[model samples]
Target: MDDKAILHQYLRTRRDSLLAKLEGLSEYDVRRPLTPTGTNLLGLVKHVASVEFGYFGEVFGRPREFALPWFADDAEPDADMWAAPGETREQIMELHRLSAAHSDATIDELSLDAPGVVPWWPEERRRVTLHQILVHMCVETAHHLGHADILRELLDGRAGQGSGDPNLSQRTPEGWAVHRARIEAAAVEAEAAASAADTGS
Candidate 1:
């Protein structure tokens, strides 16, 4: 594959992983915020869809057939970062997948050097090429995938980098607890030493 094709493939791989994180999870569980910042599996997917739609569709002046309610003028800020009360898991998942398809079309139809404007980006970097937007979107998708990975694992103990073979250590719960205590103890020791050095004690 060419350079653009390779980038698209990598982005799709991460997209699939993002969706996979929600698999076997209930609507409540998938949408439940697991972090202090309200990070959740479903919310991360929603955010990715919005990113794809904006980066690929709006940037290229290619209108999508569907409207994104999350981007409406009156929509609450960070609305894309969550699924609403009435929002179903299927709906969010479908939107993310559809957005991916839309982005893929943009990637396939345009040349890597095709010029476009990023309205939301800084003035100095508003004008961008297809290659640039593709990379940006890929980076956005991958970053969110990391968040999704952590949320999924915390929600269901399903820890892995992605689909296929797992990346989790094959350790029992007892072993993991001991490992965690050791790390905590080491951190405490290091902090105490640093404090003493600062005090010249």
Candidate 2:
């Protein structure tokens, strides 16, 4: 395959891996914050969708139809990283699929050296070739897909790539309770030490 074709394939595979991780999850399960930092399966997917649209679609002047309702010009630039109340899992997923199609179309129509302007980027770095943007998008998608993998594993002990084994399930209730208690205890101890140090105790 050609360089653009290779990058496009890589981008699709990474996106598929992320979606596969979310299979069999209830809407609530998909949205549950798996980390203190609010990383979750669906939210990560949403963020990736926004980036695909912004980088591939907008940069090439084929912007997606959906308006980013949560975005503000000057405040909280990473607002796309979280899901808002109105954003459904299906809507986010469909938006991602559409964004992928649009981006792919842009890739098909433009040569690697085709000049495109990223107006939102800094003036000095505002312009780049289609090849540069495609490579950047591939990296961005893969990085966030890795985050989704970890969040999915923490949600239900599922790990690794591809559709996991059919028999996977949460641990028995008693075992899970013990595991939770142990982790919570460790967290409490860590917090106490930090608090004491801050107070010079």
Candidate 3:
């Protein structure tokens, strides 16, 4: 595939990876905030969906067909990043699917070099192209993908880069414990060395 196709393929892969983190999880599990910042699996999906809607839809002058009121002008900050008390799994997931479709349409209709402006970006950097936006979204989604990995693992013992393959060592529990201990010891040594150097200086 060409560069644009390649980018879309990668973006889709990351998006799916992020979504897969929610598979087999209960509504409460996916929505529960494992982190102190209240980031959750479903919330990360919601956040990325809105990211695509804005970056691909509004940036390209192709206005969104539907309104997302959570992040509206007067809405609470980062409101789109988390589901409200009454929000359901189906609601968030459906929105994600629709937003992805809209973003996909923008990617399909525009050339990689097609230029547009971001109203929310700094004035000096407002002008951007489909290529840049695609790349930016890819990175942004990847960020959430990583978050989902840890959050999912925290929810259960399942840990891997994706649903298909975890890419982690197949070591037994004892082996993993030893490996973790070794790493901790090394970290402690490194910290001590740094502290000694600071005292000497």
Candidate 4:
């Protein structure tokens, strides 16, 4: 595949990886804030979907076909980061799928150098091309996928790009326990060493 196709594929991969973090999780598990900053799986998906459409759709002058109520002038701040009580998981997932389709269309139709402007960006740096946006979105999506990885692991001991992905060490339950204990011991040792050095003892 060419450069654009390659970039698109990478972005698609990150999107899939992010979505996979929700598998086998209950609604509460997916929506519950995993971090003090309120980062959650469903919220991450919603935030990415919103930005994907804005970057690929509005930036290229291809107006969105649907509404994003969170973006309205009177909506609560950071509303896109969390689903309201009335918003179902299906709705958020559908938005993600639809936004991905829209982004894919933009990627497919435009050359890498096709110019666009980001109105929401600082005026001096708003000008961009399809290539820049593709790279930006890829990085952004992967960043959230990293968060999803940790959140999913916190929810359950699962981790990796997808189900049964062999990217992680194949440790049995008892082995994992031993591994964690070893790491914890190392951390304590390191802390003690650091304190001793700080005290010049």
Q: Give the TM-score of candidate 3.
A: 0.91
> lDDT per prediction?
0.87, 0.80, 0.88, 0.92
lDDT of 3 by residue, 70-104 (tens): 87889998788788888888888888888888989
What lDDT score goes with residue 32 in model 2? 78
What TM-score does candidate 4 get on C-alpha atoms? Answer: 0.96
Q: How far is 174's C-alpha from truth in model 2 (Å)? A: 17
- Rank list by lDDT: 4, 3, 1, 2
Q: Cα lDDT of model 3 overall?
A: 0.88
* Model 3 lDDT-worst window of ten: 157-166
Clashing pairs in 3: 160-166
Clashes of each: 0, 0, 1, 0
Where model 3 places Cα greater than 4 Å from the true spot, the runs are 162-166, 196-201
Question: Model 1, residue 187: what's the lDDT?
Answer: 100
Candidate 2 collision pairs: none
Residues 1-201, model 2: lDDT tens digits: 999899889988988888777798888888878778778888788888777788877787788776776555764755676666787888888877887788888888999998888988899999999999988888988898878877877777666663344544456668767988999999999999999999995
lDDT of 1: 0.87
Regions of candidate 1 where Cα sits further than 4 Å from its true position: 162-167
**Candidate 4 residues 1-201, lDDT tens each?**
999999999999999888878888999999999788898999999999999999999999987988899999999998999889999999999999999999999999999999999999999999999999999999999999999899998888887854467788878779989999999999999999999999996
Per-residue lDDT tens digits for candidate 1, residues 144-201, read 8888877876886667753335566677778888998999999999999999999996
